[model samples]
Every structure is written in structure tokens, then in C-alpha cells.
Target: MDPKVLDQAAERAGIIPEYIDAWGQRKVISTETKRQLLNAMAGVADDLALAAALPPVWVVREGESAVLSVALSEPADWVLTEETGRQHAGYLSGGRLALPAGLPAGYHRLALRRELRHWSCQVIIAPPRCYEPAALLAGHKLWGATIQLYTLRSQRNWGVGDFGDLALMIEGTAKNGGAFVGLNPIHALYPALPGWASPYSPSSRRWLNIIYIDVGALDDFQQSSAAQQWWCLPETQGTLSALRDGDLVDYAGVMALKLSGLTLAFRHFITRGPEDPQRRSFEAFVREGGESLRFQSTFDALHRHLTLAGHPTEGWQQWPEPFRQVDSDEVREFRLKHHQDIRFFSYLQWLAARQFDDCFQLSRRLNMPIGLYRDLAVGVSAGGMETWSDRTLYRLEVSVGAPPDRLGPQGQNWSLPPQDPNVLFARAYEPFITMLRANMRHCGALRIDHVMSLLRLWWVPLAGSPQQGAYVRYPVDDLLAVLALESHRQQCMVIGEDLGTVPQEITAKLQAAGIYSYKVLFFERKDPAQYRAPDEYVPQAMATLTTHDLATLRGFWQLEDLRLGNRLHLYADDAIYQRLLADRQKARQALLDALHAWKCVPAKLGKNAERVVMSPILNRGAHRYLALSQSALLGLQPEDWLDMALPVNVPGTTDQYPNWRRKLVREVAEIFDDQGITRLLREVDRLRNKSADGQNSSPRPE
Candidate 1:
């Protein structure tokens, strides 16, 4: 192929032909890479709808009129229908039409008429920026704890954390003057395939993970004699005891027990008449959930049915002929025969949703400002219902990943498929919009995982290595506008997890749009010891001591993560292990030096880096230092308070180590009731209040 032709194709497909790596070296994309990527994108790149007479969608900021371009040769008549059904008429003559000024910020419909032909376009009027809570703007610095919901332990919980635990944690934390609680991505994962437990790779982002359902809290558990009898069984009690006592979550065992109890509840729930208040509420939720809900329930039912029937194919892709697609005749026939099974799954969703909302309300009643902040994963797995329900929106032949960088010399392929950018625009971003709306519900704030995705994503051809991937651009301006519009409408704050090798372009854009930047203590550093000072941290950010991806404070200090990594063979060889050891030693010394500089080093155990253990003072001091950060939100973790030394996840190794199964050392009630933990949290609250009282909290570029 001619070089010019290839370059043009790359440009048309939104591929960046060249880029700089994390090491500051300029690397040009290879011809073979371009060929592979172009081939993967061919299905949607040259989409006919993208080149229609008028663009499929138009984005106009509020308080302004945007000119719409069309393909008409003469004057055309136009009608702009507001979201509320009111219409505004206009004329087009200069090959463009200026949309009516002062259009409300929403999704609206516009139609153009020229002679006997008519054209339609979706219009999105966006706000200038995302929502900023009044209290934040009024200078009320706040603090919160982000946790892996499954890791939480409590007296009432059946091994894994449930909605009941969340309510208790929220109420307890709020009583201690904490402002909010954060969670890992709680999106739906496969119940049938219980071992596929990573929250990042979910079955559907729109639904709840039924594993977190507090089945005992449901009315069916109280009303049904069968459920009560099952709960009292010796076998059931034995399984529950083992799960609760173990240091790791057994996803399979937990599901088995929960499902058995939930099934009894569902049986009782179905016995109620449709007109009963509880039945009416469930029906309303089903109606509101619409096709998306039906798709989710149907997928779960079919997957479960096939698994029990000893079907060879677990994923829908391998299902025998007719059951592959979501809307196939065989699937419809299966649904007709299994309507009750689908309804059972739908009942679980309703129960889970109600419990989740109740927790959010608990935060509100306790006067917590940012009650619940949820995480949204970057992409969906290839076999997920998100793709099966609509194949055109995603290109499963290519995977979204990161290009080679220092940490990962071979780069990383996150098995999640990339969405077709052309389809996104041509469909007026309905897929994107629908996802945002669903996540924003029942939360005061939403954290977007790997948020740099709004600008671009590294797309690796499935047949190629991660290093063979090229960058694909997205419509950042339009996406940000849409994000801002939704944030304001939902009255939720947006936090972009802009960590890792981030591009320079998104920093200013995120700040301008009022999206909070995520800053981790380990990464915000000038060197190993010269960490980013508290006063220097960005105010429009959520400053945290650690994240789910990194080592906890205790693990970092004790070098437990390095040892664990070595055991798991996460490092390549002995030489790599030695280098990590050398680096960790320096890091320990640096942290000690920094703590001494902060003047909060505990007297009993903060003497020398080599001799020091992960003592209470050092642990508390780590959080104390972060609490004094100029960042508006200071996030702490429960692991740090209990001084635990293991990580919840190990990035590279899959079966070599149990990645997402670690449980907290203490239950929720015990964590809050402990005097030392309470003192640490109360100190955080004090520091936040002190910052609000004309302290160093001010927005700055990170």
C-alpha cells in the first residue's frame, strides 16, 4: 500500500501514527501496526451514517447558538424540538442553520426540511462545567474512606460485604464526622461463572452485582418459612462459618449460600399478587429497566441454564448456533420457556438496588455531604452482555490496553474490547450517555476509572502483543461536554482517575470542567523522599494515602508487597527483584525523612528507617500527613488503620496468587469502635475542618 494512502487511512480511523513513550523517547507507529489496527476498525471507521447530510448529532453549550452544517443546496426549513416537546422553527440559507439560542441543556431532536426531503439530528446542549457541590465551593474540606466492598467484614455479613454492612459503615463513619464512603466498581459480574471475580472485568456495567445482596434483609426472608428453614440448616451454617473465618473471600461458596437463600425469597416474592405494594414496586422497576434490564436478566438466566445442562459453551459466543446473539429466535424461544427464571434474576436486581439506595439514603440522613461515590470501569469484557446486546458498538477483534512503558516493558493488554468511535458519534453517543446515567444514579459522586479514555485509548489488535498497539483518538471535547451535562443534571461530582502515563492534554480540560483529579501519595513525588508537599497538592483533587492498585501504607513500609510480588513471580528475575529491593530501601528512608520534616513522627517508634516497624505512630502519621494536604478531599483506607501488610490485588499474576480475595482484618463495627482507629479518623476530620477554616486548601495544577 502507498504510504500516503496508509497515513490517510490512519487519520480517518483516528489513529495516531506516532507518539512518545513514558521514557520520553519518540516512537513512530509501524506500517504493520497501522494495517492491523485499520483492519480491526474497518467495520465502523467508514460508516455511512457518519457521512450523512447532517451530522447525526450536534453539541451546543448552554447560553449559545451553534451553527449546524448541512448538505442541502438551497434554503431549508427546520424545526427544533426541545426535550419537553415544545418546538422552535428556523430557516437555513447560508448552508448552515444557527440553532435557537438559550436551548435548555438536554437531549433534543431537530429536523430539517428542504423541498420534499427531510433530515433529522440529535442535539445535546451541555453546561459549561460539571457540578460542584455548594459546600465544596463554600470551602468545606472533607474526608472519606474508599474500600473494596467484598473485603468488608461484619457480624451480620455472610462472609462477603453486603448492603447491610455498607449502611453500618456509613452511619458509623458519619457519626465520627466523616463525609463519605467510596467503593470499588460494584458493577454486575457473572453469577454463574463465580470465579471470574475481578470487578474491573464485569458482565454488565448497568446492573448490580447480586453477590452483594443482603438476602436476609429482604421481606421474603422474613415471610417465607422455606427461607427461614434453609437459613437454619447445619450445612448452611457450617459453610457460612468457614467463609466468615477465612482470610480470603470464597466467591463460589458465598454465591452458593446466597443463591440458595435468595431462591427461597424469590419463590415467596412470586407468590404475592401483582397489585401488592411490594409487587407493584418490583413491576415498576422492571418497567423502568426496559430492554436493558430484560437483556441482563435474560443473559443471567440462559448462562445459568446452559451451565446446569452441561452445555459445552459457557460464553454466549460459543453457545450452539441459535443462542449466540441476544435477539436470536432461539433466545426468544428460550426466554418464553424460561420466563420465570428470567423473572427470578430480575427480582434479585430489584432487591439489590433497593438495599443500595437505602445505604445512600443513610448517608444523606447522617448529613454526609458526598454520601456514596461509585467507580466506573474503563471498558467491558469481550463476552459481556454490553457487547452481545449490540455488536456494532464494540470491535471485539481489538483490545484496549496500554503502550509499552517503563513499569511494563511489554505493555499491558486489559482484555476489554474498545468501542468504535465512529459508532459512538453516529449513534449520537447513546451508548456512552446511557452508561453514565446508570452509574450516576444513587450516588453523590462518581469516579471514572482510567478516565484518560475520554481523550484516547491504546488499541491492541487481538493477534498482536500490547507493544504492537497504536493510539486511537476519541472526541474529548464532545465527551467532556456530555459528561458535564450529565453531572449537572444528576447533581453528582465527577472524579477522573487520571493516574499512570497520562497525556498532557487532559489535565487542563479536567480542571476546567470541575472534575476532581485523583492523587496518590506514592505517585505524587519529586523523588523517593521528596514527596509532593501537602500545601502543594491540588485542591480540585482527592488526595489519598493509597489505592487498590498500589500497596497499602503498612505494606509499603514493611516491604511486604515486594516480598509478596517475588513469591508470586510478578517480577521477571532475581536481578529485577534486587533492583526493587534497592528501590524500596531508599523509599523507606525517604518516607522517614519526610515524616521527620512533617514533625508528626511518633516518638515511640519513628527513630530510624532501618530499625522502625509499621508502628501505630508511623501508620497514623502517614494519614496525618495526607490529611494536611491542600487537596479538598483526603481519602484513607481501613487496611492502614489496622496496619495490615498484604495487598488486595497483584496486577500481573493471575492464578499464581489470589488477587481480589483478601478480607479485612476487622469487621466494620470493630473498625469504628476501636479507640486508635477512631482517633485517627477524628484527627482527619479535624484537619479537614481546619483546612476549611482558611487553611491551605486551594485549587492548583498537579
Candidate 2:
């Protein structure tokens, strides 16, 4: 193979020849890696044909002017169509046409004509920054709690946390003066494959996970006598009791029970009078859902039918040839023949949406500043509906993952196919826009997982190791512009999870776009043995003591995470295990020192870290310490309040450990009912209020 040809293809395909790794080491992409990545991408050689060809799309910052690449032979008449069906015309000069500086911030279209020459392209004008709450802009500081919803224990839930349980948590938080309740990504997971239960790897970001739907909360359940009868059965009650009592979420069992009840509820829905309010509302929802909704519903129905009928049902790729393509005649036939099955799946989505909306409205009614904040997963599962619906938008042979970093020394392949950059440009970012809207709805804030992907992503070829992956550049400037426009339109704030291997330029751009930076207490260390001071934390950030990916505060302090790692055989060698132990010791000491220095922990309470152990005193002190930070937003994990000993997720492990399934040590009601926990929450709110009043949170030196 010619080197120049490969290099040119890589360049045109947006593959970076070299990049700086996390430890400030420069690494170059090898020939074989580039060849593999390029092979997976179609039209790489012709990817940059737009440079001299017709313009794909132009994204302009609000009030910024730029000249389009396509120049006329002479001055031409130009017509502009704004997104709102508004149009304006102008005359161009000297063969070049520049967009007007006064164009509104929205999606638009432009057409240029000079004699017989004519061209048209999409136009996007983005706001200077995303939506920032008035309170935050006025220097108000707020704190809230983040939790893995599935891990939440509720007395009435069918094993795992549901939208009904979420409402209860929201009310509890709001009553305590909390600004918001943050949650894990509740994106739609495979209902047919309930055992494949990682929230980060979802079927579709454009829809909700019906698993979280509260069956009892639905109006249909209220009116359906048959559903109530099924719910009251001895066997049904026994199954629900077992699920509720399990230490880990029984995804398959909970799904089976819910589906049984939901199916009966759907029967009642279809028989409703056309003029019935709920029937009319559901019809409107179906119509508004459009083609994407149809794809999700159809995919779910077909997947369930194939799996239960003992056919190849791994995913669309494994389905019989005739049913593989979403638009195939066989699929259309099946959709019509199984219209009831399709509608059942769609009905589940409608109920989920309604329940989630109710929780958001509950937050608003209680006057929470940000209401419920939603998490957006970085990508979709490879065998999921998103990829099935659009084969052109992704490179199936390569996966989106992270290069070797502190978290995963060998690097991590998420097994999610990377979206093709060229396809995004060709579609004018409608897919990205629509996804943001879906997750942003019924929420005041959205946390984008791996937000740095807006700039670049590590593409690991399926045949290569993650260490052999190369960075593929994205149109960050344009993507961020689109993100800002959507954020403002939805009245939602944006949180960028800039956790690993983030480029410096991306960091600056994120802040410039008014996207909140995520600051984890563990990673915010100055070193393993020391940490940044309280004042050192930036103001435009969401500070937390831990995250779902890491251990709970107590778990971290007790060294349970390291022990678990050892038991799971996660370490590549004894040296790695020893190094992790050493680091944890240093981190624990560092945390104690900071808490004491910041006047959070009592001086007499375990003065020497070597002699100390994790207790309620240490946990409460840590919460107080974090709340006192200068960050505009602070997130507290419920596990810490309850002193849970395990993590919601243990990264880099599958099958060996039960990840994304651990239930909280105590139920939410039990947690908030404890006077100690409620007092801590009240104090946190008071501290935040004190900061809002321009006073230091620390009362005095411990």
C-alpha cells in the first residue's frame, strides 16, 4: 500500500496522525492502525470532497459573519430561509457571499444564484452560551444528590427503582431545599434482552427505558380491573416480594412481571373511547413520535417475537435475512401483522414519558431551582436499535472507546460503534439535535457523558486492541454551537463530563460555551497524598465526592473497592494491585487532612488518618467539605449518606461482578426518615445558602 494514499485517506477521514496522551506523552498512529480504521469507514477518500465541492453546512456563532466557500462567478442574488419559515434576500459582491451578521440564532437555509450557477446549504446560528439559570448567574450556589435509580430501594417498587420512586426522591430532595435530583441515564435498554443491563450502553437515547416505568402509577392501571386482578395474584405478589428483597436488581424477573401487568393495561387502553382524554393524548404522542418512534417500536416487537419464538434474535444483524433491514418488505409486513405488538411497546414509552414528566413537574411545583437533571449516555449499544435504524451513520467494524488512561491502564472498548463524522455533517446534525431534545425534555439540566467526544473520540478497530486505537476528530466548534442552540431552546443547562483524557482546547471551549464542568473529589487531587484547597475548585462546575463509576465514599475509605478489584482479578499483575493499594492509602489520608483543615471534621474525631476508619462522622464531614466548595453546583451521592459499602458500577468488569445492579443499603424512605441524614441535608442546604449570601461555609478551624 502506498504511504501517501493511506496518509491522505486518514487525513480526509478526520483521523489524527498523532495525539498527546493523558500523561503528556506524544504518541503517533501507526500505519496498520490507520489502515484498519480507514478500512472500517466508507468514502474516506472522498470525505473531504466538500472543501472544494458544495458546502455541507455552515455553523455561525450568534452575530458572527463568515464567507461561504462556494463563490459565484460574479455578485449574485442570495435568498435566506430562517428556521421559522421566515425568508430574506440580499445581493452578494465580488463573487463571494458572506452571511449577514444580524441573522437570528436558529437553523436556516441559504441559496445563491449567479446567472446559471446556483447553490444551497444549511445554516446554523448558535447562541454565545448555553442557558445559565438566573440564580446561578446571580452567584447563587446550590447542592443536590445524584443516585443510580436502579439501586434505589422503595417500599412499593417492583424490585428496581421506577419513575414513581423517582418522584418520591424528587419530593424528598425538594422538601429539604435541594436544587435538583440527578439520575443515571434512563435511556431505553433492550426489553427482549433484559439481562443486558448496563445503562451506559442503551438501545436508543431518543426514548425512555420502560423498565423504570411505575406500573401502579399509570392511569391505565387505575381503570383496568383485569390488570389489578393480575397484580393481586399470589404468584405475582411473591415474585414482586422477591425482587424487592434482592440485593441486586433482578432485571429479567422485574421485566417479566411488569410486562405481564403492562400487557393487560394496554388491552384497556386500546378499547378506550376515541374522545377519552388519555386515548386522545396517546394518539397525539404517537403522531408526534414520527418515524424514529416507529423504528424503536418495531425493533422491540420483532426482537421479542424472534427471541421467544426460538429464532436467531441476538439483534437485527442476527435476524433472518428478510427481516434484517428496517425498511424491508418483510419487516413492513410483520409490522402490520403485529401492529398490536408494536403498539404495546409504543404504549410503554407513552406511560414512561408521562410518569417522568410528572416527576419533573413535581420538582417545579416545589420550587426547585433546576428540577430533575438527566444524564445522556455517550453512545448506543452496537446491537441496539439506533445502529439498526441507520447503518450509514456508524462504522460497525470499529468501536468508540478510550485510550489507555489512569482508569483503564489497558484502555477500554465500550463496544459501541462510533458515529461517522461525515454522516453527521451530511445530515446537518439533525440526529444529534433530536437526541439532545429527547434527553433534555422534562429536565432542567443534562449531563453529557464523555462530552469531549464533541472534539474527538478514540476509535478502536475491532481487530485491534484499545491501545492501538487512533483519535478521530469531530466538528467540535459546530457541534458545540448546535448543543448551545438546543440547550437554550429547551431551557436546560448543560453539564460536560470531562473526566478522562480530555484535550486542553476542549476544556477551554466547554467553559466558553457555559457548559458546567464535572469535578469528582477523588480526581480533583493535587496528588495522591494531597488535594486542592476548597477555594481551588472552580465556580462553574458540579463538584461531587464520588460518581457511579467510582466507589462510594465509605467504600473508598474502607478500601473495599481495591479488595473487590483483587477478588475480581481485575489487576493485570500483583504490581498493579500493590500500586492501587498504595494510592488508596494516600487518598484516604489526603481526604482526612483536607476535611480537618477545612474545618469540616472535628479535631478530636480521628485526628490521625492512620488510626482512623470510615464512620458517619467522616462521611458527614466529607459532604460538608464538598458543599463548601466554590462550585456553583454540588452533587451528593445517597450511598454516602447511607454509608453503603459497595459501588453502583465497577468499571472494566463483566460477568465476574454484578455491575449496575446493587441496591442501596436502605430504602429512600428509610434513608430520609433517619434524623441524622435529614439534618445533614438541611445543613448542606444552609451552607449553600450561606455561600449565596457571600459568606464562607466553614465556621472555624476544627
Q: Measured by TM-score, how close is model 2 to the native structure?
A: 0.97
- Provide the clash count, candidate 1: 0
Give per-residue lDDT, candidate 1, residue 505.
Answer: 88
In model 2, which regions exceed 4 Å deviation? Answer: 44-53, 114-117, 699-702
Off by over 4 Å in 1: 48-50, 312-314, 602-607, 695-702
Residues 1-702 of candidate 2: C-alpha lDDT, one tens digit per residue? 699998988898899999888788999999999999888887744754744324768889987767775544567788989988888899877656677668888889988777887778889999989998887998999988897899888889999999888888998898788999999999999999999899999999999999999998777787899998888899999999999999999999999999998998899889999999998988899999989999999999999999888884556788898988888999999998999999999999999999899999999999998999999998998889999999988899999988888767788899999899878988788889999999999999999999989999999999989999999999999999999999999999999999866788899999999999999998889977788877789999999999998888888989998999899998888999999898888888888988988888888887677789888788888888888888999999888888888888888789988999989888888888889999999999998888768687675443
Instruction: Pick the lDDT winner.
Output: 2
Indicate the residue-level lDDT of 591 in model 2. 87
Each candidate: how many clashes? 0, 0
Q: Rate the local accuracy (lDDT) of all candidates.
A: 0.87, 0.88
Clashing pairs in 2: none
